[model samples]
Target: MRDLLKISARYGLIGSALIIIMFLVFYFSDENPLQELQMFDLFIIPIFVFFGVKEFRDRYNGELLKYWEGMTTGTIIALLIAGITALFLYLFVGWIDTSLLPEHIEILLGNLEETRDKIVEEMGADSYIESYEKVKGTTLRDIVIDSFAKKIIIGFLITSVVAVVLKRKELKPKS
Candidate 1:
């Protein structure tokens, strides 16, 4: 448990560093948030999964145990990394651009409103539009929670399959 905690913290720290580097480069170069975060996310998965597999292989023998260990480790690491990344972004945005929150909120609401409006138009339903309008103010906390929850689900889903493939074991022939 101690070792697992240590490993988890270490990965979080490493992930924080990666986030800083990626975001800094993006910010300095005036990259769009979607382009930067999306690209960064795409790049991080393989690296995280590699570490996940290596950690599990170091501790376990059976394939099932290896799979569980890898998936668990990956999921925990992903969550820690996400929390750390969010903290970094929160701090950076607070420091560099306080307007970021409003900008993002506006963008989100606009996108959601547009999508819901289109759906309502297609179905000729007033209820769907009314439902979206009920939430007049969307907070950053809500966005973060939704994003984090999605990341947790996605991380577990992807890692579970990778864990099976990356399991290290030898099979004996039937006699």
Candidate 2:
């Protein structure tokens, strides 16, 4: 367990740093950081999870891995990355740039308008109205929660597959 956590924390911090750097790059480049976070998760989450579990199995666990160990390692790394990224976003939007939230809301509104007809047809006018209102009312807490939720969920799914693939039992010796 100690080895698991130690390895997980190491990989988690590394992953978090990379994600923060990516966020800063997007912010400085005038791209949407929120969108970038979502896009990057599709790639980064799987990679860190894989490497973290592999490291534990190879370096710490004598080339043996349990399904749960892999899952836990991947999950911890994902959680750490998500948590640190969310905190950075919160501080940035809350303190540094107060306009980011409004800008995001505006972008969401614009997208809703663009898809208004399709949304109404597929869901309903009420649904569109509700969504519009939700976007307008979105808070920093909401954004952070949403982002964290997405990351953790994606992480768990990737971890599940990784754990299955990486799990190894010790071979029994002849009696």
Candidate 3:
């Protein structure tokens, strides 16, 4: 477990660093937030999860990996990345850019009508209104929760698939 954790943490740091750099660059450059986070969740993190698990199997696990082992390692990596990300987010919001939280919240509030319009078609007018009200009142805490939760969830989901794909059966010695 210790070795796995060390490997996972190293990979998690690489992934998180990539994400932080990309996020800061795009944010400071005024690129679209929607595109930036989405791309990171979809593309960047999974790539590292793949590498992390592959390395664990090849370098540490005798070139064999169980699905659960891969999944657990990847999940640990994700959890580490999420914790780091949350800390960074708190620092960025609390110290680096005091306006980040408010700006994101404001953007969300601004999209309320658009979101309602889309949800109303699928769920119903009542649901949309309820959701709109809930979203309209979203606080900084809510954003922080969502920011970390989304990545953690995405990481788990990605790892689930990646682990399966990378899992290798251990070869037994010949009698």
Candidate 4:
């Protein structure tokens, strides 16, 4: 268990570094921030899964029990990584550029509302707009945390089965 925790911590650290690099790239680039964020999200899923499987393989000798262990391991790593990133962001962006968050959050909410309205309008469910309006109380930071939680949960659940299947080891009979 100590070995597993050490390996998991390594995975978390490496993943956090990669995320910081990506964010730095986004900061320097002139491209649309939303597009850059989407791109980051697209690549991060596979990265997380890869580290998850790697950690399981390293610690358990390619064997897992019932697959759920892999998922649980993956989720743990994801949460740790997300927590670190959130802390960094809060310290740097929240504290350093306090005004930036509110401005960007308002823009994001407007974009969300517009997209939601369009979807409801097309689907002929105008009633949902009232519910969507209720979203005004939420902030971008809240959304980020919620998204991280959901992604970690679902990603771990799905990847756990894949890891177990890919890395399971068979027990040998005693002589």
Best lDDT goes to which candidate?
2
Report the lDDT tens digits of candidate 3 across residue range 1-175.
6778888999999888887887788887986443357567677678778889999989988888899889988998888778787777767767776776667666766777767777888899999778767867766566667778988988999999989998889678999
TM-score of 1: 0.70
Candidate 1 lDDT over residue span 1-175, tens digit each: 5555566556656865786688778777875352347456656755775575566456533333356667766777778767776666666666676665666666656776778767777775777665556444655565456546655665677678777777665666989
Model 3: C-alpha RMSD to truth? 2.5
lDDT of 1: 0.63
Model 2 segments more than 4 A misplaced: none
lDDT of 4 by residue, 1-175 (tens): 5545666677767776777677667666743332355445446755766666665666564445445556556666676676776676666565664554555556756776778757677665655565456455655576567646655664565466556665665677999
Point out the higher-scoring one by lDDT: 1 or 2: 2
Order candidates by TM-score, high to low: 2, 3, 4, 1
lDDT values for all models: 0.63, 0.90, 0.79, 0.61
Candidates in order, TM-scores: namely: 0.70, 0.95, 0.84, 0.70
* Candidate 2 total steric clashes: 0
**Ranking by lDDT, best first?**
2, 3, 1, 4
Clashes of each: 0, 0, 0, 0
